[model samples]
Target: MQELAEVRLTAWVHGHVQGVGFRWWTRSRALELGLTGYAANKPDGRVEVVAQGPRAACEKLLELLQSGNTPGRVDNVVAEFSEPGDALSGFVER
Candidate 1:
């Protein structure tokens, strides 16, 4: 079987995302997709989500982040793609 390429996705979620359990919701979605990373609250009222895993899984997570079905209203999502780094275990909410 051919292994899928791993990648990293850093998404900065904007709008009413800070105090609405967005990080926990993101962590749940990431874990369900078998991704590893963290969702942290930024001081600028944005939630930063970092997920690393298979390219497909990462994309799925990104989709979920902007699905408009999360804990809070996501006005916009700015995402960056890059190579995965370090060994990430479980998804986390920071």
Candidate 2:
């Protein structure tokens, strides 16, 4: 079996994303899904993350973000491709 090459995604999670441990949850989930990146609380009450991993893993992560099960509004998710970075061994909260 061939390993899937990793891709990077920058996601801006909107709506009541702060004060709800969203970043932590996202990081944990991402790690479990074999993703590499960091999630953080934005100043405008949003969560921002840069995730890099297999294409399927990245897609799954996006699906999770859009699922609206993180104890927040998750009004919208703005994502785009980005250059891969030296992400942590596991997902992290930043």
TM-score of each model, paired residue for residue: 0.94, 0.88
Model 1's number of clashes is 0
Reference-based lDDT, each prediction: 0.91, 0.84
Off by over 4 Å in 2: 1-3
Which runs in model 1 stand beyond 4 Å of their true positions? 1-3
TM-score of candidate 1 to 2 decimals = 0.94
Model 2: lDDT to the true structure:
0.84
TM-score of 2: 0.88
Residue pairs whose backbone atoms clash in candidate 2: none
lDDT of 1 by residue, 1-94 (tens): 2237899999999999988888998998899999999999989999999999999999989899889999879999999989999988899888
